[model samples]
Target: MTDTMNAVAYSHALPIDDPTSLEDVTLPVPAVGPHDLLVKVVAVSVNPADVKVRSDMDPDGVPTVLGFDAAGTVAAVGSDVTLYAVGDEVYYAGAMGRSGSNAELQAVDERIVGTKPKSATFAEAAALPLTTLTAWEGLFDKLKLTAESMGTLLVVGGAGGVGSMIIQLLKARTPGIRIVASAGREASQEWVRSLGADEVVRHGEHLTEDVKRVAPEGIDYIYSTNTVGQMDAYIEILNPFGEIVATDNPGLVDLGLFAGKSLSWHSELMFTRSVFTTADMVVQHELLTTVGEMMDAGTIRSTMTSAFSPLNAEQLRLAHASVETGRTLGKVVVTNEPLAS
Candidate 1:
């Protein structure tokens, strides 16, 4: 194999409105670390993280590739990597500190990847990892949810990527839990319902009222993927001692506002395990493997709604624009080439 490969990257932090912000380039295939697997990427998904990274962090003159979620086949593995072997099909949301999965090849920790679902296409599997990890961690890990904890869950911004997965996973894992998703648009409301939400309400300044209309007793948990600026509204809708978990960093949030109700607030960052090389990093491997099993068994479905091909700068730019709009119904993906398998 050649030492270099094709990749789309940016050297500076620029607005997505400028097409030049992300461009095609050639870079060396990343070297494998002791626990890493070298994957030949087949498909990748764009997330809000890609846009935020490109706009906020400079690549320091080196072209920095930006993509988080991907599905591919293992081409090589580091000496200490035992979880995956060459020729194994895998999927993962790669670590944040390294070169990313937008390239033809990526080196990711084996502890973070799963065998790709047999039921999904490459593009479909690619759409899942990041959002799935986020939703799973947010729901079960951060919220300490279990099947026994079945109660009303109010999912704010239910039409987007993470929200879609949260709705589906909640139903698959906790069958008896009641879900109320907030979506203002007709299409979004319908989408949330299709994913197993018991009730759909319009998202507005009066979210508390909207939720109360269906769940008169108030919500037991609040999962907000967007609209963190309206934290007060969510807090008002939560039952006393309820928990609120968020994926994004909402600025200057005051936890004291919910203190009176003894509400708990948690932020779920899926990269924490991989980034810190935590003792339980293998938990991610377990999570992804279980998710793959659920997907293959039809217990859960792929949330991918759109796909683009040829993995080039223009296509990536378009994908980034869609994520920036904060209106995409589910997930959007781009393939390295046409998906032959």
Candidate 2:
């Protein structure tokens, strides 16, 4: 193989409106770290993180690739790698500081990746990792919710990617709990219901009021996947001592509001462990492996709803635009080869 490969990169934080904001280029194949595996990326999925990073990361004059979710075959492994060997099908959300998966090949730590789900296509599996980790961590690690846990969970922006996963995981793992999902449109509401939500709250309606109409005592857990700008509404609807978790950054929230209810707030960032090289970093690998097994066992389903093909600059730009709309039903994926038209 050549030392360089095709990739999409950006040198500055420009608006998606700018034609040159994301460009197609060739970059060296990243060297494998002692614990890394070199994956020949077959597919990748776009998330809000890609859009945010494109607009926020100051690349200066150096080009930086931006993508997180990926599924592919392991082409090579570092000397110290043990979890996988060449030709293993795997999936993972790449680390924040790495070159990312918007390329022909990427080197990622073995501890953060999992064996790909046998029942899923590369595109389907690619749509899962980042969102899965985010939702799983938000529900189990942060909120400590389980199948036997009692009370209601209110999922805001329930039609989006992470919200969809959260709903499915809750249904598959926590059947005993009641679920309320917030969505504005008819289609979105129906989508949430199909995913196993017990109640649907319209987005514009008063959250606290709508939640009370169902649970009467307000919700016991709040998972805000998006539109974090309305965090105050979530705080108001949460039952006293209830916990709230958010994957998006809720800018300048007033924690004092939670003080009255003795509520606990958690910010779920799936990249934290990889970013800081935490001792428990391998937990993500274990969790993803479990999710893969669950998928193969038909316990949960893939969330991929949209797809583009022949992963290139134009397709990636289109994917970014779609995610920027912030109304995507589930997940959007891009494959290295074009789908038959």
Candidate 3:
């Protein structure tokens, strides 16, 4: 194994176009903690959090390594690690507190790692963990929507990474729930429709009119991806005692709107459980493993829409730029050249 590896890092906040925004640096392999597994990363995926963190780098501190999702082979395990061993293929979203998966090697908690789906390449598997966890918690834990709940559901921002996964998971598990996804572009509209959205509507233009075109009454649940400001408009079209869930933190929304409709609002942050080290933290591992099984069984498919080779500074910058546009259809992954095949 190599003693030092290449990584993309940033020392200060800068625009994506700035040549110094991201730099290729060599770093020593991190040692595993008592409950950690040392993984040799083969592929990594960029998320909105990666971009946000990179763009908001501290000018005084050390350069921050940014990457959340990774798929790799376990190279070694801490003495306390029992779930995974050397040579096991695993995929996971690294915790936010430590160094991330941007390097050639990463140390992740064994509890959060899961066996990669046999049907997917490392790049494909790398695209899933973060988004899948967020979507799963939002639907199952936050909104409390079960498979038996037979009602109409609305997924806002349906073409993006989290949106795509949410649609697939909901359709696969909750067979009785009807899904209507909102997308503005033609390509996105078709993408969500193909992913099992019973209907697709244009967002930001006429949400109520479009919902009327499909189901005139109102949806039973609304999953807003990043549109907290639009919750008022959606609440107007929600059924009495219905629920609304959002992953984005749009501060200080008017609660009065939901009170009148007898609607409930929920906030879902996938990192909350991990960040707090809650008692149920292992549930993330269970959910990710379940998602892997579902993928291997052909119940759901990888939502990666784009791929880049040789995980490097330039490629990551490009990926970040795409995500910042907020219109990417699905996940964007970057794989080491040796693993891309």
Q: TM per model? A: 0.96, 0.96, 0.96
lDDT of 2 by residue, 1-341 (tens): 78999999989998787878888999999998899999999999998889998999778979899899999999999999989999999999999878989999999999999999999999989999998999999999999988789899989889888998999899999988899999888988889999999999877547667777887878899888764567677777778899988887778877888899999989999999999999999999999999999999998888888899888888888888888987789899999756766
Question: On residues 1-341, what C-alpha lDDT tens digit does candidate 3 reach at each position?
Answer: 77887788888888888887878898888877898999999999999889888887664557668898999999989989888889999999989788889888899988788888988899999999999998999899987778787889999889988999999999899999999999998999999999999999878758888997898878889998867468667877799999988888878888887787799888888877768888877788888888999999999999999888888888888888888888788899998845434
TM-score of decoy 2 = 0.96
Candidate 3 residue 108 Cα shift, in angstroms, is: 0.9
The number of clashing residue pairs in each candidate reads 0, 0, 0
Give RMSD to native, each candidate: 1.7, 1.5, 1.6
Residue-by-residue lDDT tens digits, candidate 1, 69-109: 99999999999998989999999999988988889999999
Using lDDT as the measure, the top candidate is 2
Looking at model 3, how many pairs of residues clash?
0
Given candidate 2, what's the lDDT at residue 62? 93
Better candidate number, 1 or 3, judged by lDDT: 1
lDDT of 2: 0.89
Scored by lDDT, model 1 comes in at 0.89
Candidate lDDT (C-alpha), each = 0.89, 0.89, 0.87
Residue 177 error, candidate 2, Å: 0.9
